[model samples]
Target: MGSNAPLNVSAMVVNSLESSGIDHVFLVPGKLIYPLLDAIDNSPLIRGIVGAHETGSAFMADGYARASRKFGVCAGISGPGTMNFVPGMAAAHADRIPMLYIAGGISSHAEGKGAFQDATPGGIFESGVVRSLVTDIVELKNKENTQAEMRRAIEGLNWMRRAQSFISIPVDVQKQDVLPGQEVARQPYAHGEFNACEVPANRAALDALCDQYLFQSKRVAFLVGSRGNDAETAKLLLEVAEGFHIPVATTLSGKGAFPEQHALALGVYGFSSHSRAARVINSDELDVLVVFGSDLNQRDSMNWSRRLTGGKELFIFDDSFDSPAMGHISRQGIFSGISASFRLLAQKAADNPPGLPQALQRRKGWIAEINETPLYDHRFEQLGDRVSSGDEALYPGDVVKHLCRILPKDSNVVVDSGAHRIFMAHYWLSSGKGNYFSSSSLAPMGWAIAAGIGVKLAAPERPCVVVTGDGCMMMHGMEIQTAARYRVKVIYVVLNNAAHGAIHIDAIRSGSISEQFTKLPCHSWSAFASSIGVAARVVERIDELDGVLSEACQYDGPFLIEVITGVFPAPNRYYAEAEACP
Candidate 1:
């Protein structure tokens, strides 16, 4: 609970946010938001994080929620400031991150008039925010009405499924006084407080299905996704897989849900996937596929080809049964939370004990087959001899491999969109949940640095690394100053190829030899970082990379490592196929 003494509307809003358990508010301050900013500065429960851009603040909020599994809050002024949140809010919507967006509005009396920074008819933000409210402070003269409106706005924070709430407070009304009044009626269900809406599993029905699929099926596979990637749910998923002798695979968004080093772990399955997982998924021996918390999107399903789930029977356990992914698949869908559903299934397996001596033997055979398969041939490892022969410069793949080997197992890696993302997706081996973070659905550029800052804030003790491209760094490079200002330690690895490598490859595949606007002038990233008071280094050769990274990792503040790599096409089989077509 916040202070109950006499306060203004701005203080009331801040109190409500703090009461809802928001620990930080990312914002870009403006003249209209002075009162709110002052209230936030004075509040002990919430800290204000000032970002270089509104989009960066929104992305930071998104990252905070993704990493901590708690509600995130961000604020901006009206008009252009509010418009700046569109891209980041859209990304959050696509990925199902919870956020609260606060915007300072023009005075109510000036509505429809040409006032400065006026964005009237507030519907401009409706598409981005799931729920919104525009209330004038003067309309609520007493504390009772003001508290009711605030409570109504707070109710929208309860849903975590890509839920974003917007609140627009008029400037004139923000300074109005709010006297003590009766408490508003609390809702029976509050966001992040009650789990009454959590769907429960029917034990009898689940057991019967397991008997048919788990015991009788010749080959069973388990696929987990971001929705069920929590530590507790992951533990139970592993237990059930081990008990039933089932091999497990994960979507790219769900990478690290299952330990990549485990024998049954099949790595990521889909675009740029591990070869063994792809082979197992496309094999004819598989009879049943169990999906937990995956949306089965085109990317997750490798463009939804029949090779993955053509003849197999599907069992999908998700919180929402109306998911569009279930439309085409032949599946018996269980609408339940991942944790509750897995617990019941694990209990049923323990009681029934599907006694099959062949299960372990089959599991061992699959592991052996995957180990012997040359599914993922590391192109960088092949090019190592060439680099030593002075034929080729270092590639992004080489950098990723060295990072995986040198960085601590508990370190968190946040990757931005570009050729580098594909390299890290296929090569970076994650050992635990929350160890990897990315925006695969939105694939927004400039997301890594801001999101990495938020991750560092949420888990201050862990080392957070950001892998981005030159284009991405240029988009939000100013955020490095934000990191330095907060003294948040983050290792930023910039793969500088002096162009949008993915787009360049696309152009080359399209038969255009001359890259027109894709090429960019090389900028000294180390000098730019140093100007912002961040320690930085430039690594031009492969031999210098490991040592530079080691020294950068030991520094106590923000650090940047710009790896000067040559322009090369992204290592994706799909690109090769596209180039071969026609």
Candidate 2:
């Protein structure tokens, strides 16, 4: 009854995590997990943070890894519980965060024998997790190998560090026993090694390509990706852009990587990207397009493939790169380690002086032209006017921009998935490296609320904000209570559009506004916020936005503000419609 039973598999798993420096595990209890839960209850080295749902647990772990640069663990029951985490796991995998997923599994002998909740736990998580393995490490027959299996799990967890990995332990094995190890030493996995992209080979060949573009082209551009929280890389890319007098555009993920307000900063160039950035990409101003760490996914790529015509295009990326099955847009592809590529570019710039002054001047002119370009109609701005006056009623975009202005130079911003991401990318500015985070690949809802809590927990001193749409707010609204219980001081700003604004707008554009069942009736978001034991306010007008945000920032604990916003077609959708007409 004391669970002093010889080394339970669950105890070994917890010991392994403890050795690997994982101090916290997020979990939701279920009957299948009783054995493992029993082990967790007994472990002194690890603590379990009970989450409201499986997805919340997974998101919490994902955020912990993203912020702390270490592995976070999540545990759940098999079948339905594990299935609930698929979206969060997908986001973790796509975004490359280190997280371990532990799920309680049915006995191997009883599996598929019509046992209750007899799903193939590993198979269900195969696509979502980097790897899925089931172990019977506590088998009495293999008492000596219990520690070995634990070590293997830690190694496997390391592989999932940037991707979600699953360790499934059969209930019977977890309840059974094996001889405990003589001593519990910390298990070591891969040490500090750069998992970033490897630099491309054929440097001489690339130098020839760069020389040709430098001598022949009138305009060139550096399309930077998220530099993995490396501001030095950002500065180096900016220097290269300045050396060639070419504009630098960024992906949404690339927003904070380059200070967008800079004169040479072209703007975000994706589906919801700025008009000026789109114009530059659309125009003949591009002679050589250099891309870095770009996923080139639908949202980031503006739903259109880059057509390589008279000009040449180059891509430098890490693991997030997605090569289209149709074809590639690049004349030459470079997978250089990010730092190595930067070094090479620096040397290349130093060696070749291709009218640097003239190029720099030409780039300045291009920047000026971009600054003068008009933007999309401000429908949200008009909506803010319909509510209240002053800062309390600022549009979600304005609210985020203002936060950027006041946020400490070192604070990080993590956004959940929704239409609100468009606003954050377009307006928010980061002062230094590692300033922003979001899930663009899977774009799952309910991520930001839990993720913000995890981020705050990981870096309590650093203020974090979760800017999410009402739809997203609805998905994870309850998690605010979790934040309150944990004393997380993250600010939550909900862009309330009265409906599923993004989806509604998409439906309206396609001539089917009536089918927007995704939209919700106007709800008392502030009242709901108050129920979570956090301060809450609702801004119906534009002018009230600033004061509320200021107070929220100063609040001692978690806070929420629901700002009414109007939905409009995103930039890429506008273009797609125009193309459809012709």
Candidate 3:
């Protein structure tokens, strides 16, 4: 819209970002981004700040994007900067969050010419990031041409609901001319048709199938996924379970989709999930597992070949139609997301099916049985309840659990990876699917704290919680400052076990039990968060968790709760090996 002298590619880049509505750039500055730094200093459009690390920078951007549902930008120097951002990029991709990555280059002209610190940015991030590009700032015709290139990059980013990277304005490019450019489309954001699986034309046919196998099955159950976490869908899922007289189980990601406190709601399924949920999956009582968008991976699947053998256990229905049903690939058609399918089920079952009362009763009975299971106890297992009061006490799980219990019940949640993951997955609990997310597959530390920032950004009205562990906090803990700087009130829960809990268990199991090596002394993380302009507290005892969490729920802005819990005992390899062997 406007023109500036000085004529540098960095100025053009910064101008384009500000014009396009990017507010802050999360970064760890390098010589390559000197122009951008200069541009940011000169212009009021974008705020450029340093992060503890590039991953943290990317995570901060991700957090901003998630909380705002707009684009978040992460910038750094080419090689190392790009490398550090890779893990966060992968997390964004896997979770389907949009992010814009800006990296400084040696000189587009010297990319492969061995010009000083030049490295092929594209190949450098091939495996981790979903998309990337490299360009020469100096080669551009002028400011106009530079703006056009920037627009194209933005367009490419919008095309994918994931991460995209652009290596811009090498040192040479920074010295290039700036020319005016044309505008890209000035249209409002569009919500395109969500990719979904198709349903059959004849409702009668689906109803017939349901009656033949589902209604007749003695031990039918439901496994709801994130796609069907809405109120209408939840009610429908509950009704269907009642109609068929089957109990309903969920994944950690699927939690809060089915009210865990309900009689029919069996807790999360997986190695780290509640024993009650695990028992249902492992038992012979489960003859027909009606799955809805629940991708039965390691976090929810325990182990692919073991636990709930899919052959007879699964009755899958999804929109993609790729046969997400365990051991039951469709002969024809794909599965859509659970929304459409759940609606159909609800419509068809308005009559409550044939034997609804008996099914509901049976589900209730099973729930009662589960409630009696002593093995599922987590009452004093975590630290929040034990460490309330004294201003510096919180267990990550306790904060998460309190948030789950007291926050707007319909809120969305995002978690990262850590020993805290197990506690959150197994104990914090949610009412349905899609309400909770974490690095279940990757289990990378530092993921949730940043992800929490993203979740709050993505769904601002809904209360968002990010569950992190001590190890995870260190990785992206610095971003809490970013959240504070941006005025994003994302609730953070850090499990402070004083060590890499999972690795500690793994090391010991491998016969290396050096406490000195595995156990790191506790650090004052809450004070650190406070230093960064956020209200943070630490919890040591189990009883203190809930009350402090209740108090934290009242405040707004970025908040941190550090809970102390021991590394949970590792699952015996006997089961993992059994599946691996045959």
Candidate 4:
């Protein structure tokens, strides 16, 4: 009965993941995915991370990918369990984080017969749940071609980390043994989704960029994005900027893409950006703007304001510009393979050094003004003494400022959505470590609570911290228990405002009738976190906050620090500019 039958569809799928450098698979156990889950549990090379919920698992996979620069993998059963992955999938899609999603599906025999949890094309809801959100979907109905289907799906993800790839295998097909002579996908190969095919720069776009913009433009600036945040690109980018004397600015999603302290840096140009950065990007006098890896969506582009792209020569470079949302934006959309283009430019910088652009030199006074401006000049640190009715509550901005000052310069910080994200992105001075990450496009509520666990798992040597809010903790906060289960050393600092900080502040300021719904229940997060076996502390004073954070950084296990923050004095005006897009 066991004659030459060592591998089945499930085994092959698990092997493919291992060969592709996916050492962990985050998932929630369910009926249909039992075969795959069983294989994952048995695999010696891959660890299965069972989580509290499917979406939390998906977010963990996303964080792992962001931290490791490898493909993230997660799974769920069909229908309900699979549907829970929507928000996380959409977040990964918008941020262009590459991931492989494997989920169970309808049995091959009962696919169109309305089988329970059927995910067939004719089943209930059809594929409407994730049909549009993911990059591509692979449905394996025939066991004979399972490997081929997986290969096709992975190749699509390889093109660019643009979206999550889905693979759904019918329960019947998942249990079937591999056919003869067909590779069972057990044989190891090079990494699958990272196979970088050289996408040569669009010759026409490159010519225009060189001739009209770089050589002849009056003023040029480099606006880098998340895609250009890697190590090699940073150095190459610096080479080109130093060679051509182009001022560099980054989108909010692209923070830490360039050294903020560099003389040529204009800080961030999108949400919570410096005034000089906005002026430099939108100025009519600036001749050309070179954008690498940003989609310039509503948030980054000021809701498609004419001033951003209308008056400047915009050269947009990336792996591809296929987003339909970008259709209205006028510019030369170049498929330049960002790293390749940067390498070429860096080489040119060494061979032929063009003198500094005279136009850039003419703007020296303006550049000097922004450079002279201190990044941490906001005066909110003294607010606790003056405000808060003597409750010993701290401002969220001060919390972020103190964390940035004391947290190890080498640590990786994950910013979750809420008032905390605004303060961190706007006030945290990046030393160009390229370790700061935020899911800006989607901005899901409790992402970092789960994602930071995955981040810790991915980079065990690096100290990881999650900056989140009480409102976010109310959402997927139990994910901290998942961190505790694994003993992931992520220090979660929750700003306990007893309300949705941003909305509450807005209600109080706007005098709006919606204030009734803005307040949240006051609860001791440290107590709850401790009950779940996580080391917990409630910071009651500013003087003690630094010591708490420092201790947590040195701790060997998961920790949570709840800082009771007063929502008032609200991060000053400059750091709240991101609300414009919201």
What would the TM-scores of all predictions be? 0.89, 0.80, 0.72, 0.89
TM-score of 2: 0.80
Ranking of models by lDDT = 4, 1, 2, 3
Task: List model 3 lDDT by residue over 161-199, tens digit each.
Answer: 233545445666776765443334334545544432123
| Regions more than 4 Å wrong, model 4 | 1-5, 109-116, 121-126, 159-161, 184-195, 202-218, 352-366, 374-391, 569-582
Whole-structure CA lDDT of model 4? 0.77
Model 4, 1-582: lDDT tens digits are 133665788988887787677888899988888899878977888989888898999999998988887788989887877788888898988788888888898777786676887767777563577887887888888887887888877754543545578888877788888854455344544886454454555556665565565654357788888878755667778877876667888877888777777888887766666656776777786778888988887666655656678677787898754653687686646778777787777665555535435534655655575566544344533354333344666767677779888987768788899878767876776766667878888889999889998888888888899999899999999999998888889999998888787777667767674867888888999999999989999897788898898889878899999998877644434334444533
Candidate 4, residue 481: CA error in Å? 0.8
lDDT scores of the candidates, listed in order: 0.75, 0.66, 0.61, 0.77
Judge candidate 3 at residue 407 and give its lDDT: 65
RMSD of 1: 4.0
Kindly list the per-residue Cα lDDT of model 2 for residues 1-582, writing each as its tens digit. Answer: 233546766677677677777777889998878878888888887767888888988888888776766777888877787787777777876666666778777776785567776656334433233333221111122435556655554553442224345666667777766664433454335664454323343466457646666544456766666543444566666666555656777777777666666666767776566766676775665666766667565555666444322244544444333343324443445545555566666677777665655655666676677777644345423343322223533356665666677667667688876667776776676553655777666668888888887777777877788888778777877888887886779888888877676677656656565744846877888898898698998876756777888899899888898887766433344335434542
User: Which regions of candidate 3 fall more than 4 Å away from where they truly are?
Assistant: 2-50, 61-73, 94-98, 104-117, 121-218, 225-246, 305-307, 310-313, 318-334, 351-414, 505-510, 542-547, 554-557, 564-582
Error of 3 at 567 (Å): 5.2
Clash number for each model: 1, 27, 60, 0
Q: Report the Cα RMSD per candidate.
A: 4.0, 5.3, 6.5, 3.7
Error of 2 at 557 (Å): 2.0
